[model samples]
Target: MVFEKIVEILRNYKEEPELEVTMTSSFEELELDSLDTVELVMEIEEAFDTSIEMDGTLLTIGDVVGLIEKAIA
Candidate 1:
């Protein structure tokens, strides 16, 4: 459920509608810059209703999913 929501948020930033996304996909690979990352994080926080400490360590979709899982646990 979390992954699906994350993907939906990400799809807004993607140019290609058919682009493939997976847990291992990096923000860089997704063409999301630092600003985009910040925005994405904000959107995720709003959608999930939880705070996420923005950091340089988060690199992949799976990383974010894990954080959300932990945050709502």
Candidate 2:
């Protein structure tokens, strides 16, 4: 459920109808800049009703899913 939500958010934020977003897809692969990442984090937090602390380790969609799980757990 979380992964799907994240994918939706990514798609909406990226506005790339053809972009294939998956768990293994990295922010680099998505061409998201640091500001874009920060904005995405904000959107994720709002969607999940939780907070996430950004770090260097959050590189992929799976990494963010893990973070959201940990945050809400």
Candidate 3:
């Protein structure tokens, strides 16, 4: 469910018409920059009513999703 939600968030900012979102999709392919990532993290925190302490290693969309899922679980 988190992955699906993440995909929806990605779709909101999808700049390229050809980009496809799936569970296996990479974050780099979404063209998300640092600001985007921060915004996304904030959105996720609000949506889930939780806080996520992220490190610099969350460089990809999938990594963020994975972290979210882990936090939720």
lDDT of 2: 0.91
lDDT of each: 0.89, 0.91, 0.71
Q: Write the per-residue lDDT of candidate 2 for residues 1-73, one digit (tens) a residue.
A: 8998999999899887667988899899999988889999899999999998898888999999999999888
TM-scores of the models, in the given order? 0.90, 0.92, 0.72
User: Distance (Å) between predicted and true CA of 32, model 3?
Assistant: 1.3
TM-score, ranked from best to worst: 2, 1, 3
lDDT of 1 at 59: 91
- Give per-residue lDDT, candidate 2, residue 67: 92
Off by over 4 Å in 1: none
Q: Pick the candidate with the highest TM-score.
A: 2
Error of 1 at 27 (Å): 0.3
Looking at model 3, report the run of 10 residues with the lowest lDDT sum.
Answer: 10-19
Candidate 3 has an lDDT of 0.71
Clash number by candidate, in order: 0, 0, 0
Residue by residue across 1-73, what tens digits does model 3's lDDT show?
8877766666665644455776555556667777777887788777777777866877666776777878788
- Reference-based TM-score, model 2: 0.92
Give lDDT tens digits, candidate 1, residues 1-73: 9998889888865656667889999999998998989999899989999988789999998999999999999
